[model samples]
Target: MRDLEGRYVNCCSLRYGLSFFIHFCNIAIAAQRVCLSLTMVVMVNTTYSHELHNSSTNELLTNVKNPVYDWSPETQGLILSSIFYGAAIIQLPSGYLSGIYSIKKIVGCGLFLSSLCSLLIPLAAAFGKTSVIVCRVVQGIAQGMASTGQHEIWTKWAPPRERGRLTSICLSGFLLGSFIVLLVTGFICESLGWPIVFYIFSAYGGVLCLLWFVLVYDDPKDHPCISISEKQYITSSLVQQFSSSQQSLPIKSMLKSLPIWAISFATFGYFWSNTILFLYIPMYINSILHVNIKENGLLSALPFLFAWICGILSGQMADFFSSRSILSTTNIRKLFTTLGLLLPVLFSMCLLYLSSSYFSTVIFLILASATGAFSLPGMMINALDIAPRYYGFLKGVTILVGMIGGLISSTLTGIIINQDPESPWFEVFFLMTAVCLACLIFYLIFGEGEIQEWAKERKHTRL
Candidate 1:
């Protein structure tokens, strides 16, 4: 009887241990899947930019003489810009839905729809430019929902101390996705044809969506397979440091807040420069450096690879500072935000003078991208710091405003570059630099790291 009872106790212990391990694994899996989803969206959006600019236009077009199907520089720019229109429209709605309803369902449905749209792109292109633009718009809407939903998940999963690192880990997926797409899309287009790039990436998205549905839960309490001990640990940690009062969103208050506007403007400047650099880097390399398609792919990917590493390191460092109480959260956010924006501004300005030297130009590009990684732990996480409960809504608003910068940059680049290939770049680079400086000044004056009163629950009020 003694031996039998001992065995039963041991079995219980083993079961608890296994559950704890599974809980740990969930964090890593969540990060990986989010990275994959980001890769899918970025891959689909940027694939055509390289294909149209570098590949044979005759192959891409159904009728070269039919103005609608002609893959001109202007047409390529418009198509890239079109996605932002749809993305901007859905950001607010998606964030509100994620906060109020099931984050898992919103993310899964969005990714599935985006993947479906990607598969339809090849067919849409065959129809006409208008059809292709429509497909991109639909794709943008789905991806916007998916991206916004992920932030809501972080609010539930990330502990207060680990917020910077964990959020960075999740967002680093953006850089990684961009890197993978830039590196592989060129080869895929060259070998299997550009259409295959969309098909393969879309298929991967479908697979990732299935995995996300199986693995993720909306909150720790909802995860069936998690151990009681692990769940308690998570709950206790969160409750002590990051508990939200679950207040109803105070939209009027938020809009009137200067700190919120600072975040918005800062993000707008960051995205403006980022969109121009990422979307056009390959084209820029091909045009100025005169590298072949394969070289352009490899070279363009290098900046993103460095940026991903830098982003992860910055995140870890930010978490360390917070955990050890080395610096106030506000100072940490501001310092890094300045480093991320200011360094890139200087680097971009240097590009204007270094246009003649291939080696110098490449080095500056790498520095700009890698240093900009600081923004991950800086401005990107500021929304969470200021409004833990309302991060989804805040993120949605920031992204909505920010993506307009992307839209304008893309469309303007197309027009300017086409007007005069030689000197047009000067204006583009100058504009990016000026915008970054202005936003940086505004953020430094007004940004805050403490939770806003409006985000807290008041007596007798329900969230």
Candidate 2:
């Protein structure tokens, strides 16, 4: 079939198929991680804690079917942040391994391990808080490897021209996961009990893991089912950017690069803001806004649904600009990254002032999330832009920085919320906004879109 652009299309193209499969993999990765965000609401008994002051939100304590623990705010913070700690430990190593080994195997194994961890969370919870924390940490490590492997997969499977769209499609799965979990988990907790939510998602993940092992290949050339035309298109587009010859890593060069630092800091900013929304928004809505469990799930989910849409559209727009030469790669990256970071801050500030109005608060949140997704097509994939050869390793470094920031942000948020209890949201929002702005400025000043000399393949000279 010919598409509207007059290009021949293969409905069964393995490259596109791979993008979608990874998309589902990402969905599983996110669901496993964020299940705690909503479930924790029901899992913890706020009334049981002496540290907690009386609040109207304590009304939720009357109706929970599942057993609730007397977890202090600090303890809750540790549970939420433990995943990031495990993820950070694996990020660099996983990135390096993904680049050297089979992306298919690395990603598959990671997802399978993560799925296994997810399955054990309910069992862990029965043992004690410590067991659950340990389970989450292991899940985080596995998901980190899977996330890093995705960047490596694109290095081998994605055409240079199609990179933005393909990567965005895969990354959008993160938002999709958030949307589903936020929409469904609370209702499941209320109706069937909290453990069922974990059981259902983990079971789905296990099935997808089996499919991943059967269908995915490390590269376009390796897939037996990929069409010849599609294989040639992908391989030819990537040939100049990749090399089979192994060389020692240019660690020193990367350490000194301004662009690398820029990506790392920008990632930190993104993760800080993201951690607040993904992990804490449910708490904010329930505790502060007094939204019920079902309504809270639905409202929190709305922003992510819009964000997923915006992510996909921005990816398409980015590739269009690149293919048509309407803008330089640097400009495209800057423009989208700016939109992704700046407008969210503006919208979030608006959310604070308009918090008294429930409708306006939700609208602003939706706008913030929708606009923030532009970053997916922006700095999120800039490593691929400047260094396809080292994209996997570079992504790992940036993500490690991001995970550390997320870990700190989650812990700090819990500490801050615990200290004030009555009016902590404003202070938390302000700190998050300030950190995001500082990092965005660093990226705008130093980020680059051109490939570095150190990233290019070098010819070996025989002595």
Candidate 3:
């Protein structure tokens, strides 16, 4: 009787232990699903924000009847440029923040906070300049988290075989987000006025942030939703791109690298073209050149619409070259950078002369916009290819420098357009052209793909 009771108790204890283990596993799996989902949602919000402001060309000029906010050609340029100034200032800190902390947390916070800024903008404008610039600055600070965080996630999570395609997809969001933004903001501003833009973000972005908070974890070892197959797939492929080092990436070494500096410098020039087209074109059309507001929206939006084709082609081209073994990683990246940079220089130079002919202006703008895809190979992908571990820091450096480019372009253009609306705008294009050529020479000499080799050799000797 005693032996029988002891055996039964042992069996019951084993059953309870098994049940507890099963419950823990279920909770863990659910948590991972949440993380993966949130990871995706962050980009969705980014795309949404891009969409919200997309109506700049259409709504900004035409919607004004009484013109209370002072829509002079000069001020219009200032207003458009204001948002970018905010964006540039944030990029420096956001990039560096990722190196010190988790990318996921920073990005998650950014999405939610930017949404609030988006929500507040219309309210601020309603109140006056105190509100408007403050909200714009807030939006800029929120957005700063994106570029650095995105690069950090890419370096941490993405696999080499699929790296180009995945990157392209994320990169495509810049245009696609703008596309979606154009479609929504155009309709909303047409019906609701610009104030409603932030309202929409408040509702949408807040929900997405809530989802991210529950789901995302920083590292793969802890992530719950990832199946064993997926985990093995991600790790086996990605881990080798990094040499065997558990040490935190040395910032000094990365900052000093010539290739990294080349990409940074090159990006500085390219951003001038990007900002002029995306952020500043509306004023150029409506105030300086005297195009109607309705026509200006479609015209300003057209270049980005056209670039959609190029963005896709550029990504595919990047993958195609690598898969075929035609160019090493470095050369492939350089090819895109070289082409994207040079074409814009030419088109922008012509733009100064061609603004009189609307058709020629549009054509050059579209052609130039399409060439930006070329950088997909070099500046975009090289961060991952050359040093995945340190990409977070490098991305911060690049983002900081790029924002400075925007600041210079926007500030300079603001002064130029304000001074003499008729002719000096040509000088802005000319100055940018000279700068782009200087950047082209830079990439040719310094930004080789073999930079990782130099880094690895240094690491080995120290060991």
Candidate 4:
């Protein structure tokens, strides 16, 4: 009887194992089937009528289709600076719109339109001066669309706890784009012409836009593709999570805040000082320091790369202090902001005074780059901290002001450099330092955020 019972038990256990295996196989097959079907659907949807990708580096560089094109230095400066102008100026309105509508929709539309503008740059260059200017203006507006929409996404997607890393990642795109461009553009430029750079950017814009429509869902709760684990993670982290109860924030009240002005001023200083690097750094190096073209481009890239790295590092620092619970959020923000702003201002001044040799100029830029890290945790992080709800709008507000500053800085620097290149660089450097210092002191006292006070404040514009 015992032997018979043992045999029966073993048989039952074996049957149970076989059934479980079958069930597991069925689940695995179902999951694969679901994945396949979803992928097919997404792929089809991704083929939007407005898909923007076209052209290549070699094609753009070598294409002389624009026989009317003139590649003068001034024209180049206008082309580049106009993009910043448009990006900064358009940010406010675009961001406000993003807050009112779906950020995903705003970003997707902006990127698609911007990619189209990018493709037409060569066409503009081919037409005449007027066409190039028009294309550049369009490009800048497109950037405003891209930047502001990104801020909207950041506010919604990034939780307070993880905002630091997310901000770093997003902001790093500016430099990462530059770094990738630098590494890749050299080969492209060597093989083709400068036109290829814009072509490459256009391609990037298209791919990113397509991905946005496919993977990105506007509201966290409304997302179809998100798994349960991801849904839990996002909702748990947001301090002011988006909901049906909340409506769009008031634009007028936000614009009137002293903190906004302070942030704007600091951003202005950043753009003002940095534009020199973008516009005339190579010329300065070649004229003042006598560096070769190959060396200058690499050296020029260093500051931006360092600034990007510092942003990542500073973010980690903020998170570290936050976890300890020793420092108030205000203090952590203030500390990093002050450091980011102050160091750049101070180092910028050093350029004015220091003329030891060619090496000294490079050293100044490297130090300034290191200091540029300060902006990351301060303005970039603090903007999100103050109003994670209205990040797109605020980013647009401050960025627009900064672009105005850039116009002033670049214009003045250009005029001064033409007359007396050496002394003017120094003078501008010191002036920027003073301006930065002024912004810093102001922020120390007036620029801060308190959540209790958040609802009490309203922006000036109701609409």
Candidate 5:
């Protein structure tokens, strides 16, 4: 009887397994993407320190250390931003291909390729900045494809009511990865050397790529290990909502879609703020709060840890509200997006006022990140809402827009800080706030809950 009950449970839970696998996969993706943010702090030359002094003093601090390279802030920004350039090129094509081909294969292959590029990065650094950037770009391309494929997977596997929960759980892996990376990177740089960071994270992605190929399937009907009952449950749930898996691209209609535009704008703002958090928070802790490298890593990671925890919880809350019909889908998405984006802006603004208080600054940053994770259940999964059939494609478009935002954010941040590393933070916060508020307002006004006519399934006609 125990064995029979176990079999019955397995017959209903394959979707959950899929969600967990993707969750781990996202962790791998994020680890590789964010490892460099902290690692670079230790890699650069320190002949001239960029650390700032309090308002009472004006002396520039100088330190001598065994630094690996002497790349300037502008060059570092270019290297950080280069990945987005490669990712932007692939997101649209990979997103469309994932919808048309096997999502399992596309995602697995992308991870494999990205992992390989990660292994090459340390060696590339020996040649110079350009070589490192090239390797990073390749990694970005792989990550872009794999990340987009995950969205397509949800279109096939997730029930409408479960989307917020499943998608949020999966995306929370991103923050988890960032947390783990930031938490360990400084220690690793100080103890094991920075190259080991690349090797460790790359090996993780390679192993996950193998497991993904072996265990994951593009659709419920195609999964060999899924029980008949499980397969039937997924298919039946999605049948009325989506047409056949393959459909021609509705280019013209999508071009005219206000909801799509709303998603794109919101995604742009979301990623801009996220990029700042992921790339610059460590620098802020080090430069403004006067934290050492090791403590900087731990402190930088705190926000992401809080964000990850809150993201998973918010997913459940969003789903509860959705399932109980307490709020319409549009309202739910808007509500979460507003909380995530707007709250962070307020917290970030507080940083400008309390820049001198390390404890206060850390608390606000943590609060900001915790609230920002709400976006995971907000605009992030909205593509699945308006276009279940073309979710992969729409996700690609919006993510591409978001990547552009990130690219600009990283590059522009360097330019802003390089102008005067001491006093330019206000400008940075102001720009991020403006972009987020503008985008959030647009999303609230125009976003939709139901499927678009162009995205609806078409009935077959007799020849």
Candidate 6:
């Protein structure tokens, strides 16, 4: 009888595996914005390269069925910066709403809208620069909400012990998405044209939005197909870690917290460096190395691919150490965070000195990006450690600040590079190094892995 019961439970457990499948879907959703955003970068660079080479202006304009928009570098910067401007505006409100309302619907709708905007981008570009910026801004607003909603999902779904691995798996999609876009967009541009890149990625977003609605639920209790055993397992794990009722976010206290500031500032630094890599790497490859579009795509993708692998490996190592009690969570967080920031600084310095050697520069770029992936299990997951209940809100606040860094970096790169493409890249490399160093110092000083008093108080009061 006991054996029979065990078999029955095992069968039920298989039914519960549906939620595991949903994790992959979550990855797809996470990938959507990244793919769309970088696709634009690839498209713009390819179009600009085309314009530069084609000398028969009248014949080219007339013969080319779909003409690329001729925008100055400054205007291109504005278009790139516009997305982050909209993203920053929506981050806080979207987080708040996801916490209070249905995360599934909020995220689903956001992705759907963003997908629609992506589909319309080709049309917008045909109209003019302003039109393309408007489309990108709308997409950014939608993706901001979607991103916050994803963090909120983790609060409800991620088991405390498995948080590092699960969150890393989800976040790694960003790098994967970037890799795919950079690699594929180049070939797509060469074969089909830039417009097809937008259409293909938008279609992917549409499919993911549909899958999200079908497979995902806010909590275990709401999942129709989840077996009772799995539901009990999830509910039991979360109940121990989280408050049953939603409490008002201690905004004032959060703002006053040293650790929160550390996370935000560190995130700002990471974003500044990452934005430069993502938005400008294609241009760098084209302008400096004189690589063709296909080679440019493959080369640009290498760093992100390395980063994705490193992120997964670091996450597993973090979980192993935590499980074994080999290191305090605080120390682990600090160790990885330091490595992530410090190595990138060193790599950037190497780039400053060796920019002329294409092979050496590529190696440094890949190393810089890969080392930064250590932060996935470090500062990126630190919010759940300090405030699981408000992880979404905290992530939103940090990302809002980070987007400001992205905005400044993107615009500033345009201005500086426009002045002279061959200008000494040393200053830019030095600035990246300094930003990384400062953030590392601040995080090492103030970052914590312990839950804050405010979070503990809320849980205690509920008890």
Clashing pairs in 5: none
What residue pairs clash in candidate 1, if any at all? none
Report how far off residue 53 is in candidate 4 (Å): 38
Leading candidate by TM-score: 2
Tens digits of per-residue lDDT, candidate 3, 1-463, equal: 1122121222123222222222222222222111111112111122222232666765445444112343244443344446556666766577666756776688778777766776665556557655666666666666667545656766555655445655664565456445445445555554654445446646666675666566655555567665555556556666666543445566677767888888888888778767665656666667555676556656666766566567667766876676567777777778888878888777766776665776777787667666765676567667777777666667777767877886788778878887977776577778878877888788778887644753452443553
Clashing pairs in 6: none
Candidate 3 ranges beyond 4 A from true positions: 1-86, 183-186, 214-217, 220-222, 243-251, 286-290, 349-358, 451-463
* lDDT (Cα, tens digit) per residue for candidate 2, span 94-179: 98988889888888889999989988987888788899899989988999889887788888887766777888899999899988
| Pairs that collide, model 2 | none
Off by over 4 Å in 6: 1-65, 286-288, 354-357, 415-423, 457-463
Whole-model lDDT per candidate: 0.72, 0.83, 0.60, 0.61, 0.83, 0.74
lDDT of 6 at 210: 87
Q: CA RMSD for every model?
A: 8.1, 4.5, 13.3, 14.4, 6.3, 5.0
* lDDT per residue (tens digit) for residues 327-429 in model 1: 8999888888888888877887777776468899898877876778888888887998888788888899988888887778777887899898887878888
The TM-score of candidate 5 is 0.89
Q: What are the clash counts of all predictions, listed in order?
A: 0, 0, 11, 9, 0, 0
Please give, for residues 196-304, the per-residue lDDT of candidate 5 as tens digits: 8999999999999988878887778888887787677667778888766477888999999999999999999998998886678877877777877668768878888
Full-model lDDT, candidate 3: 0.60
Ranking by TM-score: 2, 5, 6, 1, 4, 3
Candidate 6 global lDDT = 0.74
